[model samples]
Each structure stands twice: as C-alpha cells, then as structure tokens.
Target: MVGWLLAGSMLAGACTASSPEVERAAPSGASEATPATEASSQPAAQGSVGRILEHLEALDRIAQRNGGTRAVGSEGYDESVAYVSRHMRQLGYSVVSDRFDFDYFEQLSPTRVERLKPRKAYVDGRDVRAMVYSGAGRVSAPVEPVGFDLRSNDHTGAGCSSDDFSDLPTGSIALLRPGPCYYRDQVVNAQEAGAAAVILAFPEFTRATGVLRPTLLSGAGIEIPALAATDGTGVELARSRTRLRITARTRYSPLRGVSLIAERREARAGDVLMVGGHLDSVMDGPGINDNGSGIATILEMARAVAAKEPDAPVRFAFWGGEEIGLLGSTAYVESLSSQQTTSIEAYLNFDMVASPNFVRYVYEDEIAPAGSDEITDLFTRYFNRQDIEFKTIDLGGRSDHGAFIEQGIPVGGLFTGAEMLKSRRQRKDYGGRAGASMDGCYHRPCDDIDNINQKVLREMVGAIRHALFALLTR
Candidate 1:
C-alpha cells in the first residue's frame, strides 16, 4: 500500500491540522515519479485558479455568442465541444470525439389551459404543465372524470385498471389521479379508451401551489396529449360541468451530442486513472456553477498533467447531454469493450463543485468497490491537510458517475450542493445561508459566471490538484 506524504501548505491557502494516515494501493504497473514528472509537479502554477477562471470566462463568452446557454442540442454546446477539443489538441494530447443520438425537446411557446364552459384561462407553467412526452396539439373537449372518486384526494384505484376507462367517452379528455400503478400504465389505459387527451390531477397535498413538476416518462408510442393540472383547477374541471382546451407548442426531435476524450501522449499502458465532468448546461441557464466549475477544474488539471506527462494513461472526458440525463457517459461506457472497461482502474467525477453558497462534499460511495474508499480518503486527507471542513454524501447515481458504477467500476466524485436547502449546522460549517439552497440559481437563467464563488473554486481546484498529484505519484 502506498501512503500520502504530508509536509507543507499549498499555494491557495493555509494548513494547520496534524497529518492523518491513509493507505492507498499503487495502480498496476505504476512507477515512481520520473525526472520529467517531478519537473511537471513543480510547474503546478500552470493549473492555477486564475487559469481556470480564464477558461470559465471563455465558456461564458461562448454561451453569450451562441444562445446564452451550453445546453445539448444548442449551438452553444457544439461550440463548447469545439473549444475543449481545440485546447486539448494544442496541449499535445490526442483528442477523440464521440457522438450519440438523443431526443431533444424544447417548449416552443407559452402553454395554455382554459376552461371552455367557465371560459377561464389559467396560468401556464404554473397552474398547468404539459408532460414531457405529451403530443403537441390543441384539444377542446368535454372533461370526463375517470377512475375512483374524483372528489377525494385518496385515489384508491385511480387509473390502475382498464375497467376504469370502460365508461369514458371517446371524444373527451380523461381526468385521473395518480395512484398505485406506474404513470405509464395509467396513461396507456387512457389511450386505449380512445380518449382524445389525458389530464393528471394533482392531489391537494402537493405543496407547490401552482407549480407542476416535470415528468420523466418518454411516453414513446402513446400519441394523445397529456397534461398536469393543479388541485384547484382539477376540482373545478371534475365537479362543474366543464369543457377544457389545452395547448402545448412543443418540439421533440433528434439531436446528436458529442463527448470529448483526451489522453496524454506519454501514457501507453491500458491501466488508467479517468477523470471527467459533464459539459452541458441546462436549457434555462449558462450552467457556470452546475458544471462549468467542474469542466474548468478538469481542463486545468489536464494542462498540468500534460506539462508533466506520465507513463500511466490519464483519460480526461468531457461528457455531453448530462442535463437531460447521463446519456453521454452511459453511451461511452456501453461503447467500451470488456477489456477497456476492465483497464480503467478508477474514475473520479467532478460535478457542481463550485456552488455560490457552497459546502465541501465528497462522494461517500458506501457500497462501492474497494478503490472507492481510497478515492474518498484521498480527498479527505487533502482537505484535512489544508484545514478545510468537508462532508460526505451518498453516491446515489445522481450524475455521470452512475454510468461507471453500473459497470462495477469504482466511482467517486465531489458536489457542493444543488437545490436542497442547507441545514443550520452546515451554515455554521460553511458560513452561508442555512435556510436557503446551497445554489439559489441551480438550473435557472441566473447561473452565469457571477454565480461562482472564487474562494471555493480555488480551494476546490487546490484539493483536486492535490488528489491528482497523489494519484500520479502513487
């Protein structure tokens, strides 16, 4: 087992704590740092926080030049791929680009929900929402409440069986509540009943007054339109003699997303240390903090590693289509050969590492492979040596790491926080607003360059750098 050596503080900040012992095994065929590797480590200034910020500024400009977002299926994301590929080639690393197909969706115009009988227009995106895979069209038809007790919140057998839709009219929209069965089943039932459309009524207890949660189902074959309605609107449609009109102008089409892979020139052996971050932003924002932070960190580290080329292979992957799902990473893993999968010793993922209101979070990987503990320990020891506080979060397949974990690869990562509200104790530990979300602008239009916390960004860079150095030197 190789052990981390502690001695002094880093360029970013102070270190006061006593060193703690942690054991990590050397990778297969790993060697001690050569003269070139030693020289490369000394030029750590190449990967400084300032350089990372420059890259971030460039990404922001790229987004601005495009459609103000680096989301998949947008020109901004294509330019981002070009940018990363160009930089890696200039750094003398051989770059590879892989493209994959994905379903691209966009809400083209404001959705409309109206009660024809009462002649009222409810708010769009709030009181009503068009489910993801809903067919794009307008339907003005009678509202036929189906399934168990439409007036009650306790929907016992709502839309679970075909019998529920037997009496439903063909030219009407079926109103049903979510119940015991999968939503897909309920939707299928409604479609088989020859209903013109389907409306899912929210239960009274749904806290967000008018906000409709987006659905994940792709609703592949069922062509009829589907919509979600708030409890108040639902109640009005159910009890009162009502006819409703729903319109959703949405575009669903195919788009190709690219993931960039760069390998250091000197690396020859298949045993690899892989690091990655998703490069795509959500459609609503620039995604500077959600992922730009992580991509910047990895790019800078790749620059540093290139400067001090090592014999062991280091793969730097910038994935696409992560905002929609882990599509890019999943495709990459699926494309890999069995030999290639086994060749990867470990994967370190960095996502949302620089939230505006931040916490130092490391992926715990409680049920992970043996190497996962070592990966977590590396970050832990580095933070300890720097006198920084950090917390461990369960790796519950929330990011690209899920793809690697699915292949039984030891995966670990870092995330500051997302939409989850921080606790009082976290506030005391991180010196941020306890009651508010760690990142207030998560997945919103406001997540521009200004959303990054430079202090945390620098610290995160420092910690990641330390961990990479340890990995290479081990």
Candidate 2:
C-alpha cells in the first residue's frame, strides 16, 4: 500500500520556507552561545563525538537486529529508545521522557494486485496500494481514463467538469495526473466534480506515490474515496477499454507519539538551541538512512555537549509520529505556554545528513542566520577546503524544524537531499548523472548501514560538530 516507508521523503522537495522578517543581528545586549573555542580539544562538555558515533552504530546494529521499522510504538522503535536512554543515563545529564499517547494503525493486508484481463493487460497492484490515504472506496465503473486537469468546483464522472459533475450520474470515477497542484487536491477536485471516486497518478517507474496532507479536506468534507495510482496504471487501463473494477481502502488517522526533553540551565541567555529528528516511520521498511542518519547525528551532538556541559545548555529531542503528521513535534510545541514560547535563540535541525554522493544543502539563508551563519559559511569553506560542491535551499518545515519555524525562531540545517528528481543543472553539478538522485531507497527497508555513504557520514559528523561547537562553545 502507499506506505509511510516512502514516508515524507517528498517533504524534502515539498518544503515551503517560513517568514523571513526576524532581524538576524544579535541584539546589542542579548546573550548567545559562541562557537567552540576548542574544536581540537577533547572537551568533556561537547560529548565525545567519536564515542557518540560508536554508540549510534551500536543502536544501528541493534535496530537492524530487530524488525526494520523503528517507529516509537513498535519493537524496532523500543530498541532505539533503549539504546538512546541507556546512553543518556550514562552521560550524567538529566533525562526526562515526556510520555504521550497516540492512535496508531498498522497495515494488515498485503497490497492486493489483480488483473481482470488475463493476457491483455497485467496490473501493477502497487498503484492501488498507494494513494491509499486519499485512497479509499470502491469503483465498479469501467475505468475511463481522461488526461487533463480535474477542474475545481464540481465533478461527476469521466470527462466531467465542475458544472458537469453536479449533474453527473452516480458511480463514476475520474483519473488525474500529478501536476497543477497537490495530488490530494487533484483527487479532491475530481470528487468535487461529482466523481464518485478519484485516481491521482504518480511517476510510473518507482511505482511510488507522494502524499499531501493539508489542513483541509474536499468532498464536502465527505471525501469520496481517492487513490494515487501509477501513471502506468492509467496507461494499461487505456490499452483496451476493459472494465477496470478497483477498490482501495486507504486510511490516515491521528496518532499520538512520545518525545524526550532535557534541560541544562546555562545563564538565562534568553535563547534555546534545539536539534532533533522524527522517531517514526511507515510500516514497510526500516527508516535507517531516511532518518537513522539524522537521529544519530543529533543524539551524538547532544551527548557530546551534555558530557562537558557547554556555556549554554542545548535541548535535544527525538520526536515521534513525524511520519504520520509531524505529530510529536507539533504536539510538543503546541502544548508550550504562549509565554514560554519566545525563548529560542535559533533552531538548527538535521535530517538525512548522510547521502551517497554527499551533495550538501544549507536549508536557510542567502547568508545563514547569525546563530548558524558562521556554520553555513564554514560548510562552504570546508567544501572549498576539500574541493567539494554544495548548494543552499530555502528554509522548509518538511521535518521537525517546521515546529520551531512556526514559533518564529531563526532555523537552518544540513541535509543531503531526498528522492529529488535531479535536474540538468544538478547533473552538471555532480556525478552519478545529471538526473541522478541522492538515494532511491529513501524510506525503504534497504536504507540500512550499508546504504549509508561513509564519506557522507564523515561530512555529517564534521558539519554537526562545527555547528554545535560554534553554537555552544563560542
């Protein structure tokens, strides 16, 4: 089914930058942590970066030992929690597990794939499996494929339009392509057009579908079942006007998750440095590289700093239910007292810091935030130092960072890209191919230690170290 394994990888490409109105200059008399004066020293205050890596590797091994899925409420998730909790206890820092409950769902049936026309057309069952969230309901109408925009305001059936849909006879399904707007929106539009059902197609090859969870819903709020199918699915159904009977029962529900919070009171610097990664994943694959890379990077950074206790205490978290709807982070931030909100100086988030080719991107500024500007500049300087190439992208809340940006904190971070459809320009920028992506098995189970790029891992370690050192040591 359209599993969460591919979970939010599109978030990397789908991100939208928040407001840029906040002045970046350090207020004339504000207190802020400076860069580590001692990058070279094995300072106890900055948790042992090396040891933290070893610990992360251990967690990796243990998680791999269990099921591939490391979602917090699952077995793999529990193992990951145990790994981190054990390490935190040993580090001499105060640790508190903020427990919360969430409604959770696990897939039961294997994605059902069938062919009504034996030799004439074989169906790729995966499409029916995908778009499952927007995908639910049954369609017995002989599949009618129309290639065009599913216009707004109304629908009824194949070739139906806004006004056409209002009069459309019942039991009709409309199929749409991936453009013009959200895949979810296209489906909603079709259903609005009076379509009893809808099909949103994804790129054919990957056989994967992308999801869009807006704060709104269509179908008069009574959503007609919508599904994300492969573009190829439409093609096969078109080869012969065979009646294509389809049924997709997908679902998206509210799930509660847990988050851990720790406080180290540095002077009331009037700011907080926050770093974290989501702690949940879809039911199919193990979300290792998709996030193990990110979680490991932040935990290590926190452990290193907690050991020595930097000038300013850093708040490190491992969020839950991000795959579902950014639940954990959203809940935590939303629960904060409005008065307790503005104390953050900056938020430096890390997600998928390691990739095969390691093409780094700074997720913020033309010039990074002052809190992280030096670090961004340092990244460029480092690449220049190593004759490497990198790029900068707009700040986006596709990850846990979204929570902080909603709170108006200057946010930025390091990422090694996600299932990006590489461009011609990108092809010339690096190797593999201009159209080559960072990782194809982004949210899949194959994204384990082997999938990780060691060189990329090294770069992530360096980037995290530099940013933390600069934020806490200076």
Estimate the TM-score of every prediction: 0.78, 0.75
lDDT of each: 0.72, 0.55
Candidate 2 ranges with C-alpha deviation above 4 Å: 1-66, 99-103, 113-128, 132-138, 144-169, 179-196, 204-225, 235-242, 249-255, 265-270, 365-375, 381-387, 422-434
Q: How accurate is candidate 2 locally (lDDT)?
A: 0.55
Tens-digit per-residue lDDT, 1-474, candidate 2:
111222222332342121221212223332333334423422432344455456556656766666766755677777777666666666554567766655444333433334456533323344544433444455666554555333432221233224423544456666554443334455555666667765544443334432322211212343565554555665565554355455545555554456766555542355667777765544455666667777777776765676555546577777776665566777788877766666766677777776664456766643333444555555554444444466766543667777777776667777776666455555566555545556656666666666676565665576666666666655
Clashes per model (N, Cα, C within 3 A)? 0, 26
lDDT of 1: 0.72
TM for candidate 1 is 0.78
lDDT of 1 by residue, 1-474 (tens): 000000001100110111121222334323433334333433453447788888889889988887788888899998888889999898888899878888776778777888876589978655777665567778888989886375554544367678888899898989876655445567778888888888776552132434333343353665777777776667777787488888878767877779999886778766898999999987667888878999988989888788766555889999998776577898999999999999898899999878988877877754566678888877776565455678776645557887888888887777787665667767887899986767777766677889888878877777787677777668
